[model samples]
Target: MAHDAAYHWPPELMALLTDTIPLLCRSKDDVVDFLRGAGTSEALLGQFRQQLAVDRGAVSKYRIAREVLRQLNEQGDQGLGVRRALLRRVTEFEDFSTCWPDDQLKARGLVGQIRQVVGVKDSFTRMQQERDREHEARLADRRAAEEERRRRSALYSDLRAQLTALFPMEDPHKRGLELESLLNRFFALDGIGVRESFTLRLEDGEAAEQIDGVVELDGQTYLVEVKWWAKPLDINPVSRHMTRLMTRADVSGLMISASGYSAPAVAECERFLALKVMVLGELRELVLLLEREESLADWLRQKTRNAKLDRRPHTLLGVDF
Candidate 1:
């Protein structure tokens, strides 16, 4: 018969009889006896004894009750009945020297170790997520830099094309002169506020000749000569030209060449403290300055076209030839 109510026992008093039971008996009579020993009321004990006698002849009923007690203990119930049953089992096993074998104990330990390794794998997954974020950030930075460089390169190429179209020249020297003039004009239009050129009469007076270009800044005049020599430029001619311009005593001179300069020419140019010399590579930077002044670019295009028409032989004839 199943007990109709629950019960409790103090652990200190219960420990004395813990090893006395064998195989943890769960008979109703055992329950009644435990309650009576704990000083339960006679009325409650009488009711329990009546229930116990109803199944006294049925062994199967007793077995079922024992199995229920075992399940409750394995599931870790805190009820007094389950606790008493668990303590009885512990005592019975201790008295009989019953213990799990080495192999079974080892298998349990390995299962616990596997659980620890799985926890470490979870931490690795988190670290890999952090690394993926960092890698994506670096890739984003590189793409931004590459995009900026591509934009600058395109602007430079466009400006170069425009300059070539505006100042097409069969002679490389004339091309150099045209390039210098356009660059100076662009500089002035961009608010540099400098005089850009001057004409000089030769001593023999065969024809009037113009110096390449000039710029005035802060009360100083800078005479300039431009060269587009595909080969190296000797500085002697440039030095001589600058000397002539400097005869006025008020002018400082500069020389800009598309091709590189000879070493001696560079040294000669350096001799004059007020003179500056720049080569093709340096001149390429002017395109960047022009990009910031779009109006100057437009004016240069117009001036170049007008100059072309004026120099045409048909225009000189006064009729459409």
Candidate 2:
């Protein structure tokens, strides 16, 4: 049956069954035979047979019909299937062969009513299917969101640990290289496109320029430079990056400094901000962002916006501590 096991037939169906079954079957034997063919068990048939024996054909058919329906109702959905099948059989009947000649007209009237019952059953089945589908969709979305949350949490923990370890390293050169790798992974975690350290070779196969890394953000591409010097960066390194940016009109520049920039270096970047899109970031800000589990891309984009609108290349994010 399309309905639940706990489903109770409404009074309309109960009344319909009361009128329809007895009219369709002339005697107790006829009723037993019809139910048997419709898959009712022998035990139930024996119970009904015992009831008919008590009445000995003296009981009203209406009483007999109700008794039969009561037994089927107790059987749950299994009983429901047989009851619905009998109703459908009434609608499909070509003739009133089972009905008495006098009751045939009344029996014919029931086909339309039976169709309404079937219509309600079909509608209820469709509603249940739609509810099940919606529940499954919600579960799928929740699973995906939870999986993404766990993935980002693990990546944040790894990056934070790696950054902490680098501050204690004695060799600045090796520390800078590891910093480049860590930054690339950080950008990748935010779904940004990243290219690791690459060198531009001259025509004679000698290295002309060694770019620390490259990344694409918000539709603009940038050549990245990484520095972890003991002293602050001077104007010369910033000037060289400006020269590189000048060579490619389509490309921008970003410099990440562990020790920050000198006054002249900041001035040089500010001066060049009018000519190209350049953004300077302090490594400490990145550390703070990671400690708070903030977005590196969003922080950099804010710096880029500051450079574009305010012509300030080295802008520090206001950290609470």
Candidate 3:
């Protein structure tokens, strides 16, 4: 009995025929022989017979050929030859020139392209995560370093304040000499020293001139004059003082004032001693040195205790609270 025309094969089975016609059948005669002997269902056979009767241009052939090659590349040639030969028989009259429409082909190609884009996006996301972690680590390191520097600066400032309070100066000469001594102690220099009330007498029947203090630093002797005046002093006297000190070979001179020096005095001192004369701010920087000594904290505590005792009033003997 002939197969009924109303019965059709499943769409998925029909799609299989469309994908396998290309690489197997070489000629129309080969396709006819393949269909007659294949174990296809009666309904599919009838559809194949009818499709073979139509003009080949009305069916898609090149799409079937390309689809077959793509499947072979993807799935390997595992017993696919028989299916290829059956599809060729159903579309024996179809030419490669009359294939599916361009839109249908483009739609099929989009799936693979979308998968490639998703892979690229995933790689970019992973790289960004790594960079973010590295940036955070660097920020953490910078914060730690800044905190350490602040700690060091605070420690230095505290030491300077303590030294400034220790040496209170009433006279300019006494103040400058004491300041020079403090500087020497802070630096811990051996031969480089500071002495107050240094008396000098010239061999040419000269009257004795007492220098406030003499500092020997770096193999050079410096005669320093100190003043604690409320107002600035004239530079001419300092210049003259420096001149006398300079005449004593290998001697330099500096003048320090708590109220600061007059502009003319500063300029004149600079002219005589050049770079040897330096104006140091009274802001003591002794903390840097104190921090290095292990016994400084104990020493400061003792001094504070002594100061407190001295400030207290003497009690009557054997008096009870």
Candidate 4:
């Protein structure tokens, strides 16, 4: 479409292209064969390709003719012409049969009324490339998410094994202290920070109670009690935990017993219902959750919510899903 370069084309070459517009429908191979048969050499071929871009000197005379020949062989048809001293332009359907019969060019219009193929091939190629890239990006994101989940699961499982190995201690008081240490280490590994046993004051000079453990995890304060007694804990101990929790309306309580509770105590806890006050947990559930590499903080929060909403806790037992 560079009319100025066309202007540089020699008048003889311009006349030749205008006269032989129908001859442009041939394939590149057919055109080459014709040129070779006519004794046109490879040097002439390169020289002809050069003239289409610009007219530097004597070689530029055939530029417009060669440009039309190139486009015809590639696809469809294009013609060179003069209008107001500029080249007239249009790309039209090329008739391949014209090359074989050598007579179809005269039968068809010189720059005929064949409809333009609306560039479907180019658009399809571009859209497919975009879809491939999007698919690859989504696959990469899923792989990264899976790798992070596996890392968290492996770390939690290792810490769980350590905690499980310490369960055989016979002395209740020493076992309770070791259990508390293990709980702290487990909580830290699971990304929750905890505080040691603290003395709770009743807004007076006297200390009201000694908390077994205190932890602010998942936006709630937990007042924890750990018991590893050989005997099943009766209602008295469970009732004591409920009383301490009731003292502070905002605090949630965790009562983890290795030996578990008596039938009457379990019955009392099942009937116990309050708002974010108590969460009944077992040493077994902690072991399972850690062995499965699950989040203890998340389990505690669910239990705490269940106490308020469902009026029941200790639902984490034997859960595999």
Indicate which candidate wins on TM-score: 2
- Residues forming the 10-long window of minimal summed lDDT in candidate 3: 312-321
* Candidate 1 ranges beyond 4 A from true positions: 1-161, 166-169, 194-198, 202-205, 274-281, 291-321
Please write out the lDDT profile of model 2 over residues 194-296, one tens digit for every residue: 9999999999999999999999999999999998988899999989988999998689999999899999999988888778989898899998888878888
Error of 1 at 301 (Å): 27
- Give lDDT per model, in order: 0.48, 0.83, 0.47, 0.63
lDDT of 1 by residue, 29-91 (tens): 664454344433455446446555685555333343343334333433344554555344333
Q: Mind sharing the TM-score for model 4? A: 0.53
Count backbone clashes in candidate 2: 0
All candidates' TM-scores? 0.36, 0.86, 0.32, 0.53
Q: Which of the two, 1 or 2, has more lDDT?
A: 2
RMSD of each: 21.7, 3.4, 21.2, 12.3
**Superposed model 2: Cα runs more than 4 Å off:** 1-7, 50-61, 77-98, 318-321
Q: Model 4 off-target regions past 4 Å?
A: 1-129, 170-174, 184-209, 214-221, 267-276, 294-298, 301-306, 313-316, 319-321
Candidate 1, residue 192: lDDT: 50
Query: Candidate 3: misplaced stretches above 4 Å?
Result: 1-162, 166-184, 187-191, 201-207, 273-321
* Models sorted by lDDT, best on top: 2, 4, 1, 3
Write the residue-wise lDDT of candidate 4 on 10-55 in tens digits: 3443444444443643444444444444334455456544543364
Q: Which ten residues in a row have the lowest lDDT in candidate 1?
A: 312-321
List model 3 lDDT by residue over 1-321, tens digit each.
132332222233444443434223443333433454553334334443455578554444444333333333233344255444543444343333332454334423432333344456459768998898999999999999998667655644654665566456456665555565565453333234566556778898575776766665555565656555667767666666766665676665545454555668655644543434432221211232345532322322332233234321111111222
In the predicted model 2, the residue pairs found to clash are none
Greater-lDDT candidate between 1 and 3: 1
In model 2, state the lDDT of residue 128. 92
